[model samples]
Target: MRRFKLGLAAVLSLLLVLLAGCQAIGGVDVSKAVLGTLDVKSSMSKQTLSLQLVPADGKLKEEDRKAIEILNSLSVTIDQAILQDSKHMSMEGAVQFSGKKLPFHVAIDPKTMKLFVEGMTQPASVPLDMQELDMAFAGTKMTDETIMESYKDIFGFLLKHAPNPSSISVTPVTDTVNGESLSLQKLHIDIRGDELADLAKGFLTSLSKDQEGMKELIGRLYDTYYPIFAAYAGTSEDGKNALSKADKEKQINEAVKELTSMLNELLPDYDKNVKELLADSPELKDILSKNTVLSLDLMLDSKLKIRKQIMDLTVQLPATEDLPIKQVKVRSETEMWKINEPVTVHDVDSSKGVWDVTPGEGSPGAMLRHVDRQSELYRLLKDDLKITHKSFTLYSDEDPSILYDAGYEPVIVKGTLMVPVKYVADQLDADLKWDKATKQMTLTDDLTGSKIVLKMGSKEASIDGVAQTLSQPVQSFEGYAYVPMKFITKALGAEGYWDAKELVLTIERN
Candidate 1:
């Protein structure tokens, strides 16, 4: 049951993220145009979100209690904020829980990219690399014009397939704030019952009818959006138009291969669950296909910049013999202010002093001085980490060379490489204790005493006594434990990626 919920949540979350990504990119130009700047100040914004599970039968299960608690804790208020541009943003906000307000202030500048703790004698900052945040679109070639055009096509495709909205209305209003007269526009939108499902079906049906057309549209979007991301990755950091055609193709191909490999590895589990679900009952599919509605109320300034948005959505999930779930309702609202003015800080120059931008760790900078390109760690992939499908054996420059000396060669599993757990444990100086009776191995960081326990053939692990479900379980070969190289390394505080252009797995521990 937990797995079912998790799977559904994962699928829904992925869909939401995808939709949000498209909307965010599509709306950026509109925001910039309407606001005259990409930055807006919100001095007072309030939000509330609530969710209720109306079961077909009476009462709720214990497991459902957690969901209700989470839904109840959704009240928040942003008292003030300032951001002249993306390069500088700050906010003071609080989360309201049980009549108590937990306050927080966040200031982010691209230079420091760290959130500074305020009202303290000495300001402290967390290590966050803001510069690298834009890597999502690093390889794109999108211009304002093309981005808008793409958004139009996307929205057209969606609206054409889905049922038309039940109602949409716009009105104008005027108000004065802080001695400034403001003109605002209000928008109301509502869509009801099974409309979204029909729209989704329409989208899928369209893709089936013109797969090539869908591919072309996606390809164009990819080409436009990925260049900046690739540039941030140092793959094409030059002033040239972007990565060369060959390099771009290489990167794209590498990304596809990596994705395909990962999917293949997870496909079996997904396939089994899907088959079981379909065979057991058709009710789940019916629940998804049933009618649903969403209502939105929005306020915008004269420039068509959004100042507030409220949403109410309800899904009627018909109950079945096996599952008694009936319906779900969600409501949320957000309000903001000072939308017409540019955010500015007069106390200090944001581009100087603590706000001055700094390169991320391992990046060449004034403080770090230089990035050792020739270092063993940097050369882990025999070139830049951007290279595709290029294989280079791992070696540690540390005094003991625990990883390299372990003579652990990568093992191919599910079309991906697995590395010895001993290498990773030793690299972190985590002590490995074996319990033969339980067939479990416990890894404890010698310095921190943080423990992670793994049992052979089990996809579940325990990290610091909390259960963690793994995408892949621990396996054994020749009496040594092996795990997914990327997962194990990441657990040990390392980062890994498949370099664009190929299926090469590059793990870097810094």
Candidate 2:
């Protein structure tokens, strides 16, 4: 899952750059280029990253020394990918680390997101909704899909008033990537270290002067947040208004109008403030204008799908006797293909570790509320993860109050924690069966192939049918069965730890 997260981070960044640069650089039509990246559907990609450290006048930190020795190079390859925007994406490939290739398949879909390694019991999966989990005090009108559309509008406005792209260019070119020959368009930029300060100042100056454009963006943001504030007013904490719903709506609209008028009044001074800020920050300007170089080459297929990218960043410090560093460089190369095509991610044949709990009707808890008690997700959530809530709490005591049904919980007996059946099931793969009439319990350990049988109110149990005396009888409480922790650990070849203060027992499988 961590690997999938890293891959997803890289994908989001790459796509953001693609979208932002659509109308940014020269030699491209604004209308066509702005939508260039949106046509992408699926692809295959591989990337290599290299970082080099240069020590300087002073001795480096121990961690820095270790990094130079152990963390200099890494490579990731996505053999198959589906990029239907950022959230609906998937990839399958291997990561090169420590001279070994670790294969992985990671996917984020509208219904599910999953990560699968080569030797895992099953693919790690979760029910995913490609929408924001609005857990706000008073929920906003903004949602995942809406925010994406808003970002597109915002980026378009930004590019409209941006500095002309004399520094960036696009040219027709032919290139072979990953042994595939193709005709491509290369959008390239090479920026010197000293040019960054001027670029920043120029961009800010341009933005400050664009009153109409800035007003449009500000108005859009107001629309986004207006409903949120109004909704918050209906909640307990923020509710001060006694107005009816219709009256509240009118009042919020009036407030927005007044606030917007005040904000527009300040736009006139924005240009002045930008100038003063740049003038006041000489040290910041010096740092940006020195010791750094950034260059990028992005390739697009005939369909405007971003196909390959190469980026290099180099920084060199002007080291004195007291300086700690001299020069550092980082570079990455990525290539992609199979655009707008069907893509398949990793799947598991066995449902051992994989769980899909996206069912039921309402909120996230609806799944838990309606889950079949016999299902794997139910067992995992109720036993292993120990999640007992149907909804998230906004606020809670430092030590949360635990609620147990039928007064069912673990208790200590003879200085040993006699845990309930649900707690014993936390081994994850432990198979449990009960005979209601006889109150006989059977447990099977998958890892060790060991079996145990215990009868209620009996101190004698059997390990593989061999009778043995337990630490104590399988104590019964409030119609809930309990077994001694010491006997369970030894019988199953597991280790146990009892936290007396917490009155809980932890079992470790061998």
Candidate 3:
């Protein structure tokens, strides 16, 4: 009986394991659950100029026939050409481009063998024969259909093969220039974001309950849906210029206002929960206040400026310790310009390594034992000369011979020398040591008792027994110390080698 019970238990355990595996592998279909509305609209327009040609005798001649054939060939070529607009909207992804339907337009006059072709902004005309005219028109129609089908295919892919029948309307209009009326065509498409969102929600709700999977689905849908919606809502290139900064700001403000109003309307019931969450997360208060930006700037200047400012900001959330609330805070100001500039010197002692400076607009002289004009430390002092604007001082407290480390090398920035710590230590023959207990790293000279200790997140340094200051604090990566490589090798009498082509650095002791 005991053996039978044990066997039955084992069988049950195996079934349980199988069931758990199934649950994990076949969790909710995230694409269906979290994806909310996707709306897209596309407009394309083309204008073409045509020149008519006819036989002087008003009848078809052999030469006329050949001219017609040439025109026909040109027409087919033009008809097959596809032109896409610069503007694009991508959401969970109904991708749409600016302008009206039929990316390219072809016009043909069979009797005259005249051909006209139009793309996004340019128009071309040629004379063609009846056969060429027919072929061109057919090719144009097929091309338009293919483009539309491609759009649909992309949208279908984003919607996870779920079909949402779209409503399309095409109208032909005429415009008169000089004495002749030209054909103008417009294609309009309307997509509903709410419908897409509803579809996504319904799909997700029907799937097995998997909160994590559902959340992931929601994120994916968000990424897919926005670009499509934005493209559809914006004006086509032919119709309007790109949105200006003021216009973008206005739109963002309006969106925020609308969101706030909605939240206000719903907050009455959820206030208690929200208040509790906020109370439990004091750090989020700062983030909620200062983290608002209308758009992410893609320009080089804007990107660099924003990145430099935000790089030092860190948020730490309380985890594994307390309340189920979100906490965010800017934990470091090390990168702040004000904080990083001109480290204060406590003593004005006229020492070889000591330096003084006025606040701005003066040259600063840095004193060192052995100056390698090619080294990073030399360049740093040179660059600082412009920033300080006033004559500053530098004291080399240690033997200058230590600068001859085999692991020291120059860092290039914009083809100029800069210093990075990781590059220096690996170049020198000495081992770089990181002490997590003290959040410090030590570069020790294997031949001498001399060592330089760098504290993470501070510009302060301790070389041998003397405390010194640095222009910049040491940076850390993955809890490891990263120092200015030049400083490490120079302090250790090591040599540094930087292979620019391969972007590798080696450090070895002399």
Candidate 4:
């Protein structure tokens, strides 16, 4: 039974992943506009959940007494009682006795159509009618399928009672109740309003027509809810307790005060990081604007998948002097995952792609492959693979002398190449400095103060300890310094390999 409950929990968690961002139950919208203010006020009433038992002997067993005690203790801890505008709601009631006898407490809310069980574990099934549960469980052995079907029934019951029942699922649990098997089940319910549905449909429809408007709408929606969701999820227990009562007005005020103080203290540094990210990714501004709904969908997907790749991004507008903007504030809050891989540069014709560079280990290096030049590949080689910046270079074995020594033969037909200077410096923990006045490039190792200088249009180079002669002169073009791609890279302890298709330069250290 315990294993079955655990399996059920795992299945529910997996379902949440698959169902995220899906418009389940068709066109339902549960946005803030539809739900009004989600300022739910919850209160509890004192009630002892009792259970009646009938034994095989037609008489009460002594073990039933111990079972009741266990049930009472469990009920006190797990039972959830809430008062929403005088509509009372409670969850989970159970009683247990000694000598391995146990009885479960059952309560029903006719208004909400929610069933509360004490001692049996799991929430009252949703959307499922009583008849459905009886039919599903009848003649079935205790198995994960039985528990899952039962929970689905309960979820259906809850959906029927919800104001806006759009998307719903159950959370995972494991049963560990003493003397009886029980599992705690959480029902995740999403309610949508008519307005929200219209907004979603409008947004999706606009994607094919008015892309700019879609972008703006998505940005606005993101700004509107990001902070609200962040606060709700991040709020401390004390903060929640303070907001639970109207009488604790002062407490609520204090909590808000403390929260603002914390934000003020933290926002300056946070804003700087956001600024840096935005500088590199300007499109994020539109994605995080106030009118956007796609942002919410992205966030919900991230949370369900447990990925942290995009979460560090925060968008802000440029500050002005007269306004004296000390810090950029994030008014709305939503979570995103962080992505660590190098950013890809597309559209070589665009201004951002003019450099023909790709991000390397430490800085950007020149891109060696042209992804869209189809004629060049067909004229040179017969392969049909599409090219990207990372595409491997190809070479013919007939021209082995150009890349490798005459004694060595090439076996692989494909290879890759990189800029030699950046590759070398990155591995050695060194920095590259350029002097425009003399067209001289310097490589400096900060740890050892060792330097190498190469002057443009000159075949002579100077290492820190000795002068060396280069087979090819250093070259400079368009504010970038270029050296003999093969010789300089080889001198820096990097390796160069050429295959039938391409040449590759790789850093050997760090």
- Single out the weakest 10-residue window by summed lDDT for candidate 4: 305-314
- Per-model TM-score, in order, reads 0.45, 0.52, 0.18, 0.24
lDDT of 3 by residue, 235-287 (tens): 33223554555665555555545534543443343335434534665643433
Q: What lDDT does candidate 4 reach at residue 409? A: 24
Least well predicted 10-residue stretch by lDDT in candidate 2: 391-400
Question: Cα lDDT of model 2 overall?
Answer: 0.58
TM-score of 3: 0.18
Model 1, stretches more than 4 Å misplaced? 1-56, 61-70, 111-124, 133-163, 171-184, 201-291, 317-328, 345-510
Model 3 has a clash total of 62
Q: What is the C-alpha lDDT of each candidate?
A: 0.52, 0.58, 0.35, 0.35
Superposed model 3: Cα runs more than 4 Å off: 1-433, 497-502, 506-508
Tens digits of lDDT, candidate 2, 1-510: 333234323422333243333353445554355454544545556676677766765678776665555444445666655565555666667765445565777777666777665544456566765543455523555665566567666666655544433357788889987789889888777665555434434444555566556556666665666556666556432356534656645655665565446435444454464345446644333333446666778787766677788988877665555544566778888887666666554443435556443444223233344455664545544554445422111111222123243223546565655666545554434577898899899987544557789999999999888998877798667777777766776765556665545544456642
* Candidate number with the higher lDDT (1 or 3): 1
For residue 237, model 4's alpha carbon misses the true position, in angstroms, by 36
What TM-score does candidate 4 get on C-alpha atoms? 0.24
Q: For this target, which candidate reaches the highest TM-score against the unseen true structure?
A: 2
Between candidates 1 and 3, the one scoring higher on TM-score is: 1
What's the candidate order when arranged by decreasing lDDT? Answer: 2, 1, 4, 3
The parts of candidate 4 lying over 4 Å away from their true place are 1-430, 445-450, 476-481, 498-510
